[model samples]
Target: MRVRLVEGASLPSYADGIRQVYADVFSEPPWNEDPSAGDRYVERLAADAARPGFTAALALGEGAVGGFATQGTVGFATAWTTPDVFPSGRSYGHVAEALGPDRVEGWLCGALEVDELAVSPDARGAGLGAALLSAVTEAAPDGRCWLLTSVHAEATLRFYRRAGWHQVPVSVPGRAGLVVLLGPGHPAARP
Candidate 1:
């Protein structure tokens, strides 16, 4: 399926479908985010969209998005450039604590940071997730991009690996709860 790249200016037009996909995908398994999580995401998305380099990837299937990517699978992805100074909100702090200041600065700061990528449960195994992921990070500066995912999600970890993301080998210390993955073309990801 084709994944359309929606710039921040046009993201509001796709909010409803994106929220539905977010709720559908995250409400299950390792994420277990509640219905309210979608609400929170919508609110946060506005601020996130305002950030520099904000981009959203939508896989609109006729049945899923009502028109766009509407051939099959309903999946969406979002990403933005990591600020020169890392963020403190959401799980950013946990990531900072886990990787510490040095690695966080060297590997993540200024890189493209994928905030979310969700595919409806019914759409699993259809490759929509990967398509959505590629849509967002395909144009990263120098291919410097990264994201964090739950260590608990084995399949997700596998998916990233298959997509050529290299998992950074760092133990999640204390409450620092995430596994960091560098994109295929990230400079550091190269041998």
Candidate 2:
């Protein structure tokens, strides 16, 4: 499998693949109830990738798109100050809090907040997701990387835990518990 960075404008090309991945991975309450949510999620992701300081990566195998990961700068100031550009909804509030004000500055030096990571159903268990995430983690500035995941996603939670992310004492409304994962070499400092 090959993993590489992709542009916002190119996101549309993988819409179907992403949707398939979402459907297969999130086919339960909260996520399943909202059918259109998948499309909206992708749309928001594409828009977020278009913003400054945002980047996206895609993984391909056997001549087909298999997975994707997105990352961007995050912090209290960025959330509270730039809601228009990147809304801080209840779900993302925990992310903003985890990043805090101190880490926002580090963002200029390589700190990045992972926005999304998904692998097509056909690609799961093939290490594509991990490879895509590792690609983003390695590309982050200052080796700082962070992300949030639903607490109810046992499989996803397990995957992240195995990937080195620790449980954070933060929760999102209407979803599940959230956690943040940092790169191995990131300086140990409060967000």
Candidate 3:
């Protein structure tokens, strides 16, 4: 698989691939996201692409168009700086409420927050997800990067763990627990 970085200026060309990967991955099992969720994400991607520090990693197959690979690889990852003034919309509020101001600021603010990562079911188990993750975060300021996933997603949790993300031990209060993970090289990561 060939992983390439797509800056905000180039995100549109890959929107369809990103949307498809997202829907394919999230609409199953733990996420069980509705079809409309993918539509919402594509819409959100527009605004998100304009954000400072926004970056996307697209893992493409040979001859793939816009990156929805027909050559047996399709995956992507998106990330951006955690804004100094984090928004309260979406699940950010839940994250803020769960971790509180101190942890939020100390651990998250200014870090590269991975917004989404997904690989087509046919393309998983081949290190594409990890490569896309690294491609998006390899240049994180001070090696500070982070992401979150549902506690119910054991497989997702394991994937991040294997990639060396350190899960914050605290449980996020909600219908489902949200687990925060610090990147491998994060200064605060525990041994």
Candidate 4:
């Protein structure tokens, strides 16, 4: 499998695939919700793709999208970023606070805030998820990275933990049931 940053019109193509994954992955209990949520999420992804600081990765096999990851910086100015795109006003404040004032100052300098990651069900355990992560991590502008996942997603939590992401102690307000994950220190900002 080859993993790389997609550019041009192809970005939207991959975004579409990611939207499918979002629908499928969150179709069950815990993160599962109304179809409008997934639709809104995809819309946000499209907007993020057009953002200046955003970065995305795609995994391909036989020339087809196998998995994908999308990340970007989070701060005061862009704190209202994701919701405008995806419209998940429900957990917006929780995520914004987690990725906001506290962590954004130093830890998230140029940080790659993982907005979404999804692997095809047929491709699970094939390292595609890890590959998608590696692509995002390696491409992160500041070396620092972070994400939020439901504690209910035990497997996903384990995956991130094994990938070297550390858990933050704070609980997301609306997403009180979830756990936050952060990556290593900022590349340029580190002494």
Taking every candidate in turn, the Cα RMSD to the unseen true structure, in Å, is 3.1, 7.3, 3.1, 7.3
Decreasing TM-score order of the candidates: 3, 1, 4, 2
Model 2 C-alpha lDDT per residue in residues 28-73, reported as the tens digit of each score: 6434545566677666666676665666667655543334332221
Q: How well is each residue in 19-83 modelled by candidate 1, as lDDT tens digits?
A: 78788778888878897788778778988999888988888776544233344337788999999
Better of 1 and 3 by TM-score: 3
Candidate 2: global Cα-lDDT?
0.56
In model 2, the runs with Cα more than 4 Å from the true position are: 28-33, 63-87, 95-110, 169-175, 189-191
Tell me the tens digit of each residue's lDDT in model 4 across 102-135. Answer: 4545554345667677665555666777777877
> Lowest summed lDDT over 10 consecutive residues: which window, candidate 4?
72-81
What TM-score does each of the candidates earn? Answer: 0.89, 0.69, 0.91, 0.71
Clash statistics: count for each candidate: 7, 1, 0, 3
Question: Which tens-of-lDDT digit does each residue in 41-133 have in candidate 3?
Answer: 988989989888999888887754543457532888899999998778767888898889998998899999999999888777678889999
Comparing 1 with 2 on TM-score, the higher-scoring candidate is: 1
Can you tell me which runs of candidate 1 are displaced by over 4 Å? 63-73, 174-176
